[model samples]
Target: MSYKTIVVHLDTSARAQARLHLAIEIAKRHGAFLQGVFAVFAPNPRSFVVMAGTAEYYEEHETVRHEEHGALERLFEAELSRAHVDGEWIDETGNADDELPKYARRADLLIIGQDDPADPESFVADHFPENMVMSAGRPVLVVPYAGSFAHIGRRVMVAWDGSREATRAVHDALPLLKQSEQTTVVTISAAHGNVPGARPPGADIAATLTRHGVKVTTLDLPAAKDVATGEMLLARIDDIGADLVVMGGYGHTRWQELILGGVTRTMLSSMTVPVLMSH
Candidate 1:
């Protein structure tokens, strides 16, 4: 019911500091071991095919990579020291989107930043945040690209669909939800009504959370055919003024070419608050 270790992805991006600060706060709160992972992809050999010289291309790329890694390491150390959190820094040479998930297996939770499309260089991978969430077996906390969140898990919103994925997300978020001042579980039901033999939407889960000492409330909304599920959830998050959102990241695609579910993709692309997702 508590995070023992937290792994955070670090990079030389504008929003990296915001993510680090949030991660530090969480680590301090839980008294967890904090780890900062910097995955620096080595120069792609394929790109040399178009260039006249391979040596020069690799030399320049290596230099930039080393410089970036050093900068990230310095920032990681400084922040951890200032926060006085038990922490470690890891530097790896590989595709960030791939390596990060591997690192996540050892940690109770993983923290990563939302991709900023306007800043192409800010992306850690081709699909970035989505790829990490889909691959990491553990829960992931994705910090927004624009906003600064000084506090998290104070107010929470859970998007429930009554699927196995939803169940996993709810359970995975138990520690945070239990600490939240208020937690709202929003269920999107079919327009018809409750399905046969199923408990009322959100009722069972809300009761369960109440037993766990969470200040829980339930809200039922009819699913709209024309609107995407992610849009509905985002609107609800705004309505409730939630600082954090917990939900399942459902998706179907080959590992090489990921195609995220509509809701998963939309939330990653247009999230206003931090989101904790479990696949």
Candidate 2:
């Protein structure tokens, strides 16, 4: 399957442009229809004190929101038009944590910025990326908040394990993998949860990807002393000069709270490149 429809999250964050740039590139590459979903944090008027000046406070807040919304819409339109990519803009004012996933579910892929706590403009909800990865049934490509990624999916790395989540991620990333110049499937002993005994770790997946026209190879990571699997994966990506990583987003929701797996948390916080994750 291909990415026929792609949804991208847009806001006033510093990395919003970077996210949009990559999204447009991906859309152009796949000849896909892009949807730019604009959703940002807005404080509820009821949360403010019921005072004489409350009306003024509410009015000013709306005015700023409208200005920013219009600006972002203009920018999105201009970029898409210049790139010759077909797309539409969607302005959303609801809670992002609940609303973004609804849009994501209807698209073939969702592109979003990595959570940057220091960037006050990007604060929609706590653990926003984590929540989206777990909640959005589609694949989620999370762009890093600090870097400029002009392109991606050239040299790809897949974090392979034998779990259902990992299997789903591999299938979800098949389109990208087939287009990548080179793809490496790395199996970290600590991260390979319940690998099938029928064949060696990463072998079956490598063979399947090869059949799908992906330039695929497998690597079994050597045991490391006191090194976390996430750290190892990051180092390997850098060493191989990979532009993108595909992996499973391991997490579960509990009472509306997300409890991310250890490796997933580490990658979300410290990833150096874009990651395409599926749950």
Candidate 3:
């Protein structure tokens, strides 16, 4: 279970290079093809009405957009050449949240940057990472907005909850987990009721991974009062000194708005290490 193709989202953000470096490392590790995808956000024609001349203003906006696209392409090519990794570049014109998921379908894994609340304009699209995780049918690895990750998958922490999403995340991360020197499966005992085949939360999964030649350990944690489950998981990651985390992305849609589960939202907002998530 090795990644054959790795796709990464690139933009004008300063952290784009960090994300690309991480993606290149993963691609080189697994001998995978790397793809750099850049989404050019075109100006909306409706906004031209605010200007004195609608058509002329729209044309100028498009011209600037094209220039930016060309510059980004050059940057991507230079990086790829410097790394000397087998790769390709994809330039799309649209909202990143919509187009990235489409590109993700062809890759084994999708790499994206976590949104930085300090600079809302850092992302090319609104809710970019979150939307991709919800829409992409493949595993999405989100790199933190702040930090340089020189190594990944050396120590792994899996947040298991005995749910379908959690199971999918575990399976999707098998290649990485199998290669890790240490893998810990942490399950929070929060009194989930009457679920069939829910034998000791993380034991079964740990056994299954051990059968697959993974150096695995199981740790059961009790939820503390007045603390969110996601916070507990984050604390555990720090305690174990894990460089990577694998977990399920839980969310629901209400009135056309996608509302993420508390754990998923919290992790995305405050993650210090890279996280691999599947929905």
Candidate 4:
């Protein structure tokens, strides 16, 4: 199966253009319709305590935001025209955490940016990426804030643990896996244990991918109790030169991930390559 419609989140952040470029490329590759949804952090003036000049401040903020939004739409339309991509632009004014997930549900895939703590403009909402991963009801591709990725689906790494979430992620990522030059399933054996009937931890999934015409391999890594599985996966991704990573997101609740630590949370914080995640 291929992506028929892809939704991308755009904002005032510097990296938004990079995300748009990548989304256009993906749309071009898959011959899919692209939707650029402009959703940023816009706090409602009504939510604040009534004070003198509050209305004036709110009005000024909105004026600036609208101008910037228009500029971004022009850029998005220009890129779509230049690439000959079928697409549309959507202007949203609300909490990003709420609006993006709504848009994502109607698309085959959602492309978004990883949170950049150093850039205030990237703060569209609290834990935006994590929320989207859990609530989008579709696969979310998160592009790193610090890098330039001109290509994806070339070399892929799938973080496998054999849970329902992992199964869903693998299935959601099938389109890209079929196009990948090489795909590897990295299993954290000591931490997650083995799949029910597979001799090796990742054998079953690897075989399943093989059936779908994916050039696949498996790697079983033993992790100690004190070591973080996410760190291990990141190192292996670099060693293998993977450009895209597919994995389950927040197998546990967000609270559990925050308290006990989790691969999904870690990758969201420190991924070097683009990550496609599903909950």
Candidate No. with top TM-score: 2
TM-score of 4: 0.90
* Better by TM-score, candidate 2 or 1: 2
* CA lDDT scores, all candidates in order: 0.85, 0.89, 0.85, 0.89
The residue-by-residue lDDT of candidate 2 on 1-279, one tens digit each, is: 899999999998878888989999999999999999999987777767777798787888678867877887898999999999999999887899899999999999999999897988888788989999999999999999987799999999999877788888899999899999999999876454444343558889999999999998888886577998888899998888899999999999889768998889999999999999999
Residue 259 lDDT in candidate 4: 27
What does candidate 3's lDDT look like per residue over 113-203, in tens digits?
9987775336576677788888999999999988779779999999998888999999999989999999999987773432444666888
TM-score of each: 0.90, 0.92, 0.88, 0.90
Report clash pairs, candidate 2. Answer: none
TM-score of 1: 0.90
Question: At residue 123, what lDDT does model 1 achieve?
Answer: 66
TM-score result, candidate 2:
0.92
- Residue 231 CA displacement from its true place in model 1, Å: 0.7
Q: What stretches of model 2 exceed 4 Å from their correct place?
A: 50-62, 193-200
Better of 2 and 4 by TM-score: 2
Error of 3 at 270 (Å): 1.1
lDDT of 1 by residue, 30-83 (tens): 888999987643546777878789868688867786787788788878988887
Q: Rank the candidates by TM-score, best first.
A: 2, 4, 1, 3
Error of 4 at 190 (Å): 0.9
